[model samples]
Target: MTVPPDDPAIRAQGLVRSFGPVQAVRGVSLEVRRGEIFGLVGPDGAGKTTIMRMLAGVLRPDAGEIDLGGIDVVAEPERARAELSYMPQRFGLYEDLTVGENIFFYGELFRVPHAQRRARSGQLLEAAGLAPFRRRLAGQLSGGMKQKLGLVCALIHTPRVLLLDEPTTGVDPVSRREFWAILYDLRDSGVTILLSTAYMDEAERCSRLALLHAGLVRTCDTPSGLKRAMAGALVAVVAGDPRAVHAALAGAPGVLGRLLMGDRVHVRVDDSDRRVPELRALLAGRGIADAAFTAIEPGIEDVFVALLGPEEAA
Candidate 1:
């Protein structure tokens, strides 16, 4: 199946899935444009993994329509998979196989011609800074290096779309930055990417994001757009004890939501102009003095917390 160049690289609508009585996804829909990075952002058990699996054709959806490029993923999984590469949270990287061996193995599995596989491997290894470590055993590589190798293996066949599930979960900050740099390069080269991540920073980096909560999509928009759609103003409260500050503001009038971030508590209120002073007085009445309040710009996580509500935020 060949879609027009302007068509979405990946599309799904009314996606519904369940594991016995527990439904993991409900009416989830998404359209990823060509050459852009789309993100699925949510907490654990938000059905990120299940959605990725269904989109990858690794798991059959109980009810849904999935189109990969021009191929119907549900009706023709094999053909659709030819244009898709999915790297789940736990990618299958053979521990004993050397870096180069694993790449060759996946290339063979994809049936890439010998000449093409060799050339592709060299380019990917060098681009990922693994050219010098091609002979190292997969088990001997560091966590970050192992992830890069997994990405290299996934890209060995040059699929048009890539699905990554929390690829940077445990990687160090510096390595995570490097990994994203490679992804940027891929996107620039016209490979559409759909990835799920728990990190707000990563979510901010995506071209657009779908915020999932309890088997449903709360919202979908660009990072800045989502922040702009935030209903109220966010006020950062810094006090001696963060938890105590949160408790003091619980159910306070005009307060929409509150989230504790490190030493500060971000309180969403109906109006920052009026609530800031009122909140200060209330805190002082509770014998909490020296609390400083500042209105701050809402972040992606703030929007998520507000949408998820206090119960789901927990």
Candidate 2:
């Protein structure tokens, strides 16, 4: 089916799913625009995987509707799935097969013509920086290389929509950056992407993000918009002893919330001007006088922490 360029590439409405006793997705709804990267950001067990599965037409939602490229996914899963490629956390890559073999096999599975498969494989492998390793066995590749291989296989058919579930979970920093570069290229080439990630930094790279918590979407907006929606001013308390700083600020007035960010304590307050001095005095009285406090803009993680609170965020 030919989808209109102006319509959403993917859409879900009041999606609900369950696993016997656990309700994994609760009325989740979101839309992915064409040629953009839309991200589902949350901690583990936050229904990211479940929602991705549903969006891929691999798992049916108990209720709600899903449309992919203008096709009714729930009613015609096979047709819907043909328009999208889903790369799960553990993509099915045959360890014994060479990278080229895996891509060819997936192409056959997708029913691409022999000549088209060859051309597409060459292009995707080159784009993913795996052309040199085409003959290398999948099992012998590095973690990042394996991920890129999986992605190449998934893109073999050049589907309209791509769904990734934590594609860079255990990948090294450099590989993760490289993988994101490939995604940016795809988006530029007009492929719509919907990905789920636990990494807040990765979430910031998306064109828009949906912050999920406890099977609910707390908020959905651009990263900057979400940060601007944060209820309080964020103050970063930098001290040699982060635990001591946290203890000192415990129960302090005007403090909305507090979270530990590496060596610093990010404390949210209604008024930083009034509370910064009070917090400083509180720390000084505890014999800690050299602590530094700076007002900082909230990152994606900070916004998530504020929305879910420090406990649920942890």
Top candidate when judged by TM-score against the true structure: 2
TM-scores, one per candidate: 0.97, 0.97
**Clash number for each model:** 0, 0
User: What is the C-alpha lDDT profile of model 2 across 173-194, one tens digit per residue?
Assistant: 9999999999999999999999
Q: What tens digits encode model 1's per-residue C-alpha lDDT throughout 84-123?
A: 8999898579989999999999999899999999998999
Quote the lDDT for 60 in model 2: 91
Task: For each candidate in the order shown, give its overall lDDT on alpha carbons.
Answer: 0.92, 0.92
Q: What is candidate 1's local distance difference test score?
A: 0.92
| Candidate 2 TM-score over all chains jointly | 0.97
**Candidate 1 TM-score versus the reference:** 0.97
